[model samples]
Target: MPLPTQEKAAGMTTRGGSTSKPEKRQSGCGGEVKDRRTVEDRLDELLSSMLTRDYLDRQIKQLKMDIHAENKEITERLEGRIYELETDNEDLRKTVGSLEKEIESLHAARDKTEIKLNDLEQHGRKDSLRIIGLEDKSENESVEECVEKIVRFVTDKLEVSLNKNDINIAHRLGNFTRTKPRNIIVKFTSRRKKHDIIRARKKLRGSGQVIFEDLTRNNQQILKDAFRLKCVKNTYSIDGKLFAVLTNGKKRRLFMDTPLSEEYLMNDGNFRRL
Candidate 1:
């Protein structure tokens, strides 16, 4: 009996039961279909947004790796360039120092050469001056010394003191006047026509390392004096007493008065008593 009743409720084909159940069921189906369509649409929108976000994230990670690699390469290149520059700078510094040393050495050599040249030039000038002095002088002595020696020799040998200035001035004259303007005189004597009269006159006129005039007188007294002093090993005696006698041939005769001797005179290499 209960089974029959349950079946009758499930089927509900009676007019009253069937009518109430169908109305209620129709209302719930309509509302459920609308809600199910809305939920499906929202799930589809969420899935589309998630796929786009994942793609963008992958691209961002790849870009970051590329940027990191590029920065590393740039840093390495700059470091290498800096290293090369430093090496070049060191080499340049060494070259500059070597060049400076070479320049300094060159300057030192130049200075040494200049000093040596100056010393040689100084010595050469001194030698040239000495040679010139020899050329310009007759006696080895200085001018004043020669003058004093000759003057004293003549005075002592010939018993006469000559005026120093007068002789000095006269000796410098190149030619003579009828009256000599200067008062100095040279007197020479030779009994020998064998005497090179021209030669003797030449020597006598200008043996003083100076120019002179030939204002000469050839005479008896001048000839006698030189003969007494010139002849070696001769008895130049007057009145049985020897006067000034010549002993050596090398000795030079100095006489203020030529013909100062009254002894024999040399003629044709023979002594003839006059």
Candidate 2:
């Protein structure tokens, strides 16, 4: 037997009488190039992520600053409004105080005026007399006849020396009615004559006749109220001044403003018990 010689390539190998191709070897420079490219790509990605995070941080900072400024403006506006409301409330309190003082002043002025008016009214009726229980004989009586009748009645009933000349005016007090006789009002020329008639009125006590001092309307009301009190035994008025004689032997001088009560009567120092 004779064997022929065979030529083999660089990566070819012969094993057990068979020939096989070996794997090709990679170059060392190519592996280094691939590793450098991967490192560059990772660095680029890191840089991009850093840039995006920095942009987001700047936008958030700007938004926070804007929100802070807006909140500050709103707080300042609220503070200003609170200050304005406080100022207005203070002004309103002052106005209310001023109005209350003004009302008090008005009330004081009105009370003084009323006192003066009541005094003047009483002064006007000082020389007048009111005769009650007198018969109304005729509704058509003339002024002269009325005067003569009053003069005669005063002379006979009260036993006073009154003439028609002493009477300045004489007339019935109210509108004439058929149910009862109206009272006669007589204004005398002098207070002395009027007082004399009043003093003599005690004689006609049981004769179904009454004579009053022609008191002011307020005094008359006071007398009426005084008579209604359980503590009062008698009530009368002299020259527009009211007097109440209590059951406890005390004489109380009353005015239009006097409080009509048992406590006031018993405790008043002005009215001494007899």
Show the colliding residue pairs in model 1: 189-222, 221-259, 222-258, 222-259, 225-259, 225-260, 225-261
Leading candidate by TM-score: 2
Give TM-scores for every candidate, taking all chains together and pairing residue i with residue i.
Answer: 0.29, 0.69
Question: In candidate 1, which residue ranges exceed 4 Å CA deviation?
Answer: 1-57, 127-274
Query: Candidate 2 vs. truth: CA RMSD?
Result: 12.7
Q: What is the C-alpha lDDT of each candidate?
A: 0.42, 0.84
Candidate 2: stretches off by over 4 Å:
1-76, 270-274
Report the Cα lDDT for candidate 2.
0.84
Candidate 1 lDDT over residue span 35-62, tens digit each: 5556699899887877796777997888
Question: Candidate 2, residues 1-274: lDDT per residue as tens digits?
Answer: 6444453545456677887754444567664234555779999998898789778899899999999999999999999999999999999999999999999999989878887898799889999988888888788877887898888888988789988789999888678887788898889998999889888889997887888888777778888888888999999878877799989877988876678998888776856554
